[model samples]
Target: MTYSGSNYRGAASVPPAGGSGGARVAAAAGGGPTRRGLIGSAIGLVASVAAAGGGFSVWSTANDANSDLDRAFDLGDLEDRPEDTPALNVLILGSDHREGNAEEDARSDTAMIMHVNEGGTEAYAISIPRDLYVPIPEDPDAAYYPDYTGTNAKFNAAYAWGGVNTTVKTVEALTGVRIDHIVEIDFNGLIEVVDALGGIDIDVEVPEGQDTVTSIHEPYREFSEGVNHLNGEEALDYVRQRKQYADGDFARMRHQQDLIKAIMDSALTAGVLTDRGKLTAFIESTSDAIKVDTDFNVVGTAIELMGLRSDDIVFMTTPNLGTGDQGGESVVIYADDPENPEASNPEAVSLWEALREDTMAEWVEDNPEAAGQDEGE
Candidate 1:
């Protein structure tokens, strides 16, 4: 079963005004909605099932979501990949566009790689820090920028320079891994998705000794140390906070992971999947929040990975040597050498090898620290 390539129609479809690279960045920035959303589309695509006798609604919902994604984002030119590969690597880029933040200032706030192994029973979510210093790939789409690849810049800059296409190239160049698909997540639909499911429970764990973490946004909601029910707005505020944590963005990433897992759990336990009204609302909100590459078969991949669950997925971060000051700007000192394809951070190279070879389970066991959690006693 093969799917035809999609015909995308978005801000990326039209060339930037005046053929200016800056204009391209500005155009891409304004694409996302005002309020930040969640990674709902990623789950919505696969959460549907063709039920017996009354499966038409589910089937129809999935089809609508698929069509929405098909017309979503333009991935530019990427390497053609066969659908039957032993493993799959999907690059998920989360872009945020807040009010008062100029369109030209937009950048990918979150970047994660979802690697599904050969068996499709388990998966890995590898988050790359946006500040990780890496070599920017020359944008064939917008070649106006001089020396685009000469100086190393923050990882998220790839999206600002040329949207998804440049980001894909940069990741491929850095990890030595081929990207099977691309997903651009808009942070504007989280509220609706969470609201549709009633609300989600997130266990807020403050850093070691800290008692509680307060939201930086308005109203300053305080999250105590334990399971707290979060509505759409509260969920948005909770995950958007990073400054309160000692590790900053790293802490926020973990929270985001927690939110995603919680949403899934809430849907399952709260009967969102079984209740047609809730399910419809969930799917519709999710589908509206994301765009994907043309060839990405959301339903097909979901069907192939039917039995997958939250516990089966592990979230990890790319190896880095913490934050550092580079050229007067703070950046994440990536453990790998981005300029050279053959040379990379030893541990990161091993991680990439495991991903490429479909041996991440063994790799995770051996490198527990990089697995995003400490080994239990």
Candidate 2:
């Protein structure tokens, strides 16, 4: 499964863009998104290619749109899941390299797991709440991770402690699901990808009460409540908006997820993959901004994902018991039982089981209320 970095077309000799070096995460000004997001560019390219019947050309493009990832990590211990199965778990991280503003430690503003059911034509992009309470594993080299007095902490705290390695480990520990592939996208990647695609159009919906609060970004523009179209910069800010909403991070999470959905929808309907000039621009920017594990075989994946499309996708939120007081800090606790927190219920276990069996639609069918939607214009 090991391959040289040179094997990847877009990533050859290119410095890894997302989570490269001492890259810290920051949202739009005024604590916009807590730190980082979803795989806007990468997801866009994959779905667009599939829709356009890219075939060999898309395979080549996917192989080339690459990133440099750590090759030595041990996935040997991960629960063995058959490769032939339609189920594929990909960790999608959106990171930013910004110097200032608020959060001392870099945290992923957005985190999502894309579960692809290739054979079934059913896929899910589930948002892992950054604020969900979880145990941050002890990492000797992780400086940003706090030596917290308590055992459990926020989910994004794993990234702050040990970057991608810690985050991936934490995800496995919490969800009991092994990630098969990783795609890390940076803020610049999102911007450049949108710009290269001749700019993306996502419907912006700032909550009802954002008229007077004012934006911290330059020009201090306020996001009006409606279906406003966005470019790269505007798109970034639109998803980063959390302070204006009552739900805070939850609202931001939905918006970020919506952005990913918007990109997928746009890629399918907008003809980016079929159009040569736009496709070239998309391929270049996407490759430049993202990084994938060395084991990721893009050509094979493109072939497997032939029939996957935007309409087939479903959005979800990790089951939770809602927010509560934990260790003195308000946190989102795991829902063993949503109504009765006293019972020893592990909601994720069943969800993970469903994912393993490639029956997520069944899980969704069982818990309809747990799902989230973009509802963006």
Per-candidate local distance difference test: 0.63, 0.57
Please provide, for model 1 over 1-377, each residue's C-alpha lDDT reduced to its tens digit, 9 standing for 90 to 100. 21122211111121122221110110000011111334522353333222211365566666567666544544545654222244667777666755477654666777778876654445788888878898886655643343464458998777777666777878877777877667666556667667878898989877678888888889999889999999988988888788888898878777777777776667656365567777777667767766677666665455444334456567778887788888899898885455653454667878877877778889988898988657574
Best by TM-score: 1
* Clash list (residue pairs), candidate 2: 10-64, 36-109, 36-110, 37-110, 67-291, 145-161, 336-345
User: Candidate 1: minimum summed lDDT over ten consecutive residues — where?
Assistant: 22-31
Clash count for each candidate, listed in order shown: 5, 7
Error of 2 at 231 (Å): 1.1
How much lDDT does candidate 2 score? Answer: 0.57
Best by lDDT: 1
